[model samples]
Target chain A: MTGKDDVATLEEELPLVELPLDAWHRAKGARMVGFAGYHMPIQYEGIMAEHAWTREHAGLFDVSHMGQLGFSGEGVDEALEVLLPSDIKGLKPFRQRYSMLLDEEGGILDDLMVSRLGDGAFDGAEIYMVVNGATKYDDIGWMIEHLPDEVVMNHMDEQALLALQGPEAGDAMAALVPGTAELLFMQSGLFTWRGVPLWISRSGYTGEDGFEISVPADSVQLLADALCALPQVKPVGLGARDSLRLEAGLPLYGHDLDSRVSTIGADLGFAIQKRRREEGGFIGHARVLKELADGPGTKRVGLTIEGRLPAREGAQIYSGANLVGEVTSGGFAPTVGAPIAMGWVSLPHAALGTALEIEVRGKRIGATVAPMPFVPHRYRRAKS
Target chain B: MSRYFTDEHEWIDVAGEIATVGITDYAQEQLGDIVFVELPAEGAVFEKGDDAAVVESVKAASDVYAPISGEVVEANGALEDEPALVNSDPEEDGWFFKLRVADASELDGLMDEAAYKKFVASL
Candidate 1:
């Protein structure tokens, strides 16, 4: 629902695929919609109610459509280091870092999570990564073409990914898996549940305490049922997920982040650690370095509108008749009780507290650049 | 007052020349969680099939077209603060606008309550 602006292109003649939990979702009375080439559940009861539930309680999200990739063999770290901007060579086992794939010219190919795994872990994958579903195929192809032949890549197509997110997620998880409470943010480990092996990470898209569990596709139904059985955990659909992430100020890959957008321009420069920036070996390093030295032409910033009208994606942003930028993602943020948005505007116009206008229904609504996480992030980190 | 439904799922309760317009329950359910509604100005004129009010849900913004030509007499302002009325009572308290009927003959082309129920079944 975050990218409904681009959903028209999604309904092309391309056939829709069914989810592994297609029947489970339908049985729960979910409203199925074609998204990312799959018939996925957009919502169950109602979007607003589901949005509130996630902020207050645990929400189980079926994010299996994302690509879970496993890499092994010789020079695996070095191979990935050449493709991503993050310092993969420095990654510690059981640790996860946000990274992005870039084209030769430094255009963002896709944003992903890269994790170093323990020996012979998670299907013997030395390195585990998750990429956005809409751009997964292209990412796989790009990596395959560039990676050394000795380094092997496995697309875990038969695996399903689920995210249990919210302030209550930790308590709910500890009830199900005892050791899960020990994990700090950006940490992960392997565990077994009811004889099924799971690769879980203490991370999520929503800026809330959560875990992303990787389970075999065939066993997803059992896991989903068990999670939802907990009084604190409810089955949430993509609708709530979209709203939660938006309120958290996280970008949806296809809509907010795209090829034309650079990491610095998107305010993702933190992904390029100091080591990677100093070494400059990854693809798109030139642009990253250039943007670092000379600031990106346009910068992504958060906006708060004056009224209730939501300015959705593709809505043009203006500063008194001058076209400055366009909305990348936006909606009525349930937690804020008002409309919030993220858009890329020229550096001069992207400053905080700057006045702007967004054209909705041919009328420009007043807006102001604002600091984000429009709702404060409630991530639980390791005690100092 | 006679209630007539349009193919687009708008309902009109005709009482003499003045009629109340609102989206059907089915339309509101499909839109999902009414977040905002943009109403047309009172005394605004419109022709049949012209763009009118917009109903925005958490999902998407959908246009509720002018099912028949008329001049707007009044718009339900309560929706400005509480759009959920459209979801809870779309036929009564959820009314969008009132139109002074341009032509009563236009109702002949639309469906009655019974016909609309059957049409909904076919879909």
Candidate 2:
């Protein structure tokens, strides 16, 4: 739903696959759609209501379609640094970093969360990572082709991913997994509930304090039911997931961060550590450094739409009749109570408060470049 | 006066030369929450199968096509503020626009209520 934009390419000849909790989702009255080759739920109650629920309370999301990979063996850190711009060697145990897999030309292939497990844990895995659902196959193939044989990449195909996110997420998680509330932002740990092993991270894409729990596929239903039964928890679907992330100003994979886009132009230079930027040893390092030294011509920015109508993907943006860029992702922001959009624009037009125009249905509507993260991120950095 | 339905899920209530057009209940349901609707202006002429109106949900936007060639007589002003009316009463007050029928013969190609019900069931 986030990274994939190729709905027309869905191979109707190929049968859609069901997730581990497919029956449970149907029983809960989820409106399912074929997304990323899986019959994933688009909404439960409705997109607006579900979006509001996640901003006020806890909402559960089934993200099992994503590919989970584990890497182990000596020299794994040094090997991973060769593919990513992040300083993988400096990653502390139980901490995670946001990084991207870059093509040799410096374009991003996929964005991922890489977490180093506590020393000598999870049998042999020194690092565990989660990649976008649609690009996981290619991401794994890229790593297998590049990673040295000493580092063994294990694909956790039999596991399911669940994200419990929002303001009340801490309370709901604490009720089920007692120690989860103590985990700070970007930290992860191994835990057990009813003897089912879980690898949970205190992180999410919703710009809220939450946890992404990885559990055995067979026992996901039991885990989901337990969480949903809590007072503040409800099952949400991909519809809300997208709207929430958009409000948080996070980019979707296929729409905003395609293979042709660079990390510098995407305004994601924070992912590269200071040491890595100066050292320049990772893939596409030359281009990244050049772009860093000399600013990118076009930069990604947020837009505040003037009218009620939403400017969706591919809508043309203009600066007084001269086309500047196109909208990447946009919709009615339920929480912000206005129409907001994100797109890439020319450097001159990308400044905050710069007035612009968006042609929706041939009528030009007024818009202005605004600061991102339209909704303030409420991440809990430490135990309160 | 008889009611006709199109495969695209639009319904037309034919009364003499004026035809009341609206999407079926199934379509409003399928579209989920109706947030915005772009109704064609009065006097706008549309050919059969031309894009008549636009409907937007929280997730995506879709086009409502004309079932028969006609000129728009009036659009439902009530929907400009209360788009959810399409979800609540799609057959009655949720009507999109009134089209002054260009050719009554086009009605013969459309399915009746009974046929539309069966067509929907087949889907």
Candidate 3:
């Protein structure tokens, strides 16, 4: 969020890398900022304008900075279970699930999306994973060092990731690739367009019905241009992307989540499959089970401030004069027309409607714990 | 009346002992969209370079520093209802507040219009 191009490698003096769409974003007058290790477009037209566009129309986002990886060969699921708590072995082909990578102490290393690639796409590749851009190198190295030698790990660094999200996303995607509207949320496939492979998932972080298209680096501009040409799609920047995810109550890797945060305290218990919870085989399983049995010491909760001022990250949460917790992510919610935040607090002070105070710029602002997803999710779930 | 600019992108139009303050067009443009404006209460005293106001956009919030030591005389309450004014007409009706200047000499230290233009170009 600072002026530095990349904080992750700031001390190392490594150069800030650019995405394949760097020129394209600049052409659109995007205001680029240093995020993770990449120079990403924070906004173009404007944040409020782009945020409203995504809520009403289709907004295209360049998330190629995320690390796209593939794992294949025998015993892939068994090997993956050692790191992730999700039900990887039971994942149906072309289906995706949300999961987290945990440390030996049960603290989260990173949150990720794991999808089982359909057999029709690649004959050998079995599992597809996407990790945060900042932690990807370490994730790859960790997997390489831990997994059996028979399993092959492929980093699809040559690809660009794009998210076309909003209510009209289905219409925009179906315009380019027919039958895309039929894909339900969490479903994915390898579709061909203009003779190029497009790995698409009917899912996104905005809590909207949308598609995340993964295309070859060279073909990305073409695909982006085609999508933007549609009446429903417009290029959105990281500014709106962050606001949308904030409203959706989704946690960001380095902000809302970190190495010291457990899955339970992070409010990500859903990522742990029931079978994994009962069997207790994954890394940090004992700690997670202990929290599940005797609640976490602290828990993540949502806060709605009483005034217009935002209580940004690092703001302390106070109940009377006692410090209870600290805010991880907070900002004005464009959709809700108020300020919203997510933070971790002791279990006793984490209840909904618990009145608390957040100190912003040395002033205490009245706030209360509220239900999350300030804007209800509009995903296209499977037909019941 | 003459206008003075600060390195932080704040502008103060001084007339005798009173100064009208607001952010420059460049600051508003850099901020993207202005959703909320936090103004200091009337009669509030501030030192030169103290954070006197805050402007928040959808992406992030930024503090507006006082260009000179002064006591806030009036706050633009219009901003509370329509903060977008700061984005539309930043120099005029979008002014943030009025201050009773504590020392008129502080205005001499600020950049003039031409100097500020050159300074901004350097950034």
Q: Which residue pairs does candidate 3 place in steric collision?
A: none
- Per-residue alpha-carbon lDDT of model 2 for A1-384, expressed as tens digits? 011222333435557899999999999999888877788988899888999999999999999999999999889999999999998999998999999999999999999999999744456599999999888999999999999999999999899999999999999999999989789999999988999888999999999999999999999999999999998999999888988999999999988888888999999999999999999889989879988998877888999999778888888999997999889998888899778999989888989999999998898999999998999999988646
How well does candidate 1 score on lDDT at residue A1?
Answer: 11
User: Arrange candidates by DockQ, highest first: which order?
Assistant: 1, 3, 2
In terms of TM-score, the best-performing candidate is 1
Which residue pairs show backbone clashes in model 2? A3-A254
The runs of at least 3 residues in candidate 3 whose Cα sits more than 4 Å from the true structure, single-residue gaps closed, are A1-13, A120-123
Best by DockQ: 1
Pairs of residues clashing in candidate 1: none
Best of the two (2, 3) by DockQ: 3
- What order do candidates take by lDDT, descending? 1, 2, 3
TM-score for each candidate, following the candidate numbering = 0.98, 0.95, 0.96
Looking at candidate 1, what is the lDDT of residue A34? Answer: 81
lDDT accuracy of residue A89 in candidate 3? 91
Clashes of 2: 1
Clashes of 1: 0
- CA lDDT, every model vs. true structure: 0.90, 0.90, 0.89
Q: Report the CA-based lDDT of candidate 3 relative to the real structure.
A: 0.89
